[model samples]
Target: MLYFKHYAGALLLLVMVTGLISCRQEEPPLQKVLEVRNLSDLATTEYHITKIVKASDDKTWYKLGDRKILMSVEAVLKAGIDLSKLQPEDVIIDGKNITLNLPAPKLISLNLPPSGIKVEYQEIGALRDPFDNAARDALLAQAEKQIRRDIAATGIFTETENNTRTLITGFLQHAGYNNITIRFSPQTPLP
Candidate 1:
């Protein structure tokens, strides 16, 4: 009777272990949410700026000498949306139609290469100062500002926005989406 009791206990334990092992089955892989964004710069503007500076102070008691400097500059400006600024709610998809809210176009960069800058003419009086490196750098900075203004006046943002919409719409269409709506955030100015 003692042998039978031990044998029965061992058999029960083995059967329970086998049952637990068979009950464990492989599960399907976990699904992750899809995130979409736009970070491509599609439009750019090249600007040529010319400025004449008379480096003279009017408040001087005596009629001081004048130094005239003429500068010509070529710069490039880029505008685009920053995808990192996107939020999950910015994208909406329903069946084959999709809507995306994009950020406003911003000045991505201002490139004024030294080779593109030229001093057209310079005239300095004997008693007046000459155009030094610091003065030239300041002039270049002013040229950059002028280029920005010119780009704005030309409606570069409008062009960029249109290009972005077209590009994104095409991309979505290729990805199996039929209807696409694109809108920009009004809070971000085109400056």
Candidate 2:
């Protein structure tokens, strides 16, 4: 009975030590919130002047000042926003000295055409597996590189690192995902 008690005490002590060690392990900080500038009605619309030439009458008929006035309305919307929500007669734009006529406006939203997550690892010293510090640095570098490439290829409106995060957050928000997290791990080599 005494032996059993000693064994139990040892096991309990081991478990306690393990629990304390695990409690000391710190978790990664949460991703920062990025601010996205809302699109205004004025900056999203424009007008162009085009010359309308008549070939049959051999004359150029201009509607306004020797050019045809063409109005265009463009709204830079977040991904998953319903384009059909905008009506033809909706007051889509109110630019300075330019009231856009939205006879039919085509909506365009910035979205990731194709995005992926990648992981890589770098060895520290002669260690077979990278330690947490090396792993974290590698993961961060990979994420930043992938994010920049994705943004450039997709032509998204990401002016800075914060903007890139904002673009991703906006996409997630539009997709109805309020709480999302991105993670990376060491890449496994194929046999």
Candidate 3:
């Protein structure tokens, strides 16, 4: 009878210990995570320019004094934001609200269509050299420069900002986030 009593006490102690451990909640690890890397290509523009290239220097050298060539060029300009510049402190998750500071938009790529080049007129003097592939390429480079300048002047960055905000906001909403706040890096003024 005494042995049975000791056995019952041991069982009671075991049950109490198990119940205490089970009632205690485990604390989660202390860590801060704001991992987000979503690089997206957002905007594209097609540009066309008609430019006139005058070979005045060649005129002096080869008697091609009144040479004027007309060239037409078409190119594609792609712009987007690069998320690789995101920093750890740039993101904050608070309840249902997520605030993210995205990097500034940039011009991603420029491509001239294969069959979009047009050389309307190439006037060569009798004693001057013909307009070759090198000359055509140089003119096209000029057109490319002008196209890029025009694209910048037309506020491509603004369009990119709008598109990025819309895209990310929709994404976060779909993921069950109630509020989404996105801001771009401020532009630094040049001296």
Model 1: weakest 10-residue lDDT segment is 26-35
Q: For model 3, how does the per-residue alpha-carbon lDDT over 1-191 read when each residue is reduced to its tens digit?
A: 99999999999999999999899974421112222353444443323434444433453653645555776666766677776677777777787788889887777777887577777777766755777888778888877776666665657677778887887788778766787899998643211
TM-score of each: 0.69, 0.19, 0.68
Which model, 1 or 2, shows the larger lDDT?
1
Q: What is the lDDT of residue 157 in candidate 2?
A: 24
In candidate 1 the C-alpha lDDT for residue 142 amounts to 78
Candidate lDDT scores, in order, read 0.68, 0.32, 0.67
Clashing pairs in 3: none
Ranking by TM-score: 1, 3, 2
Winner on TM-score (2 vs 3) = 3
Model 3 residue runs over 4 Å out of place are 1-65, 188-191
Model 2, span 1-191: residue lDDT tens: 99999999999999999999898965322111111112222123222212111112113353222211121212223322222232333222222111112212212233222122222222223312323444434444544344334433332322222333344446545644556442112222211
TM-score (C-alpha, index-matched) for candidate 2 = 0.19
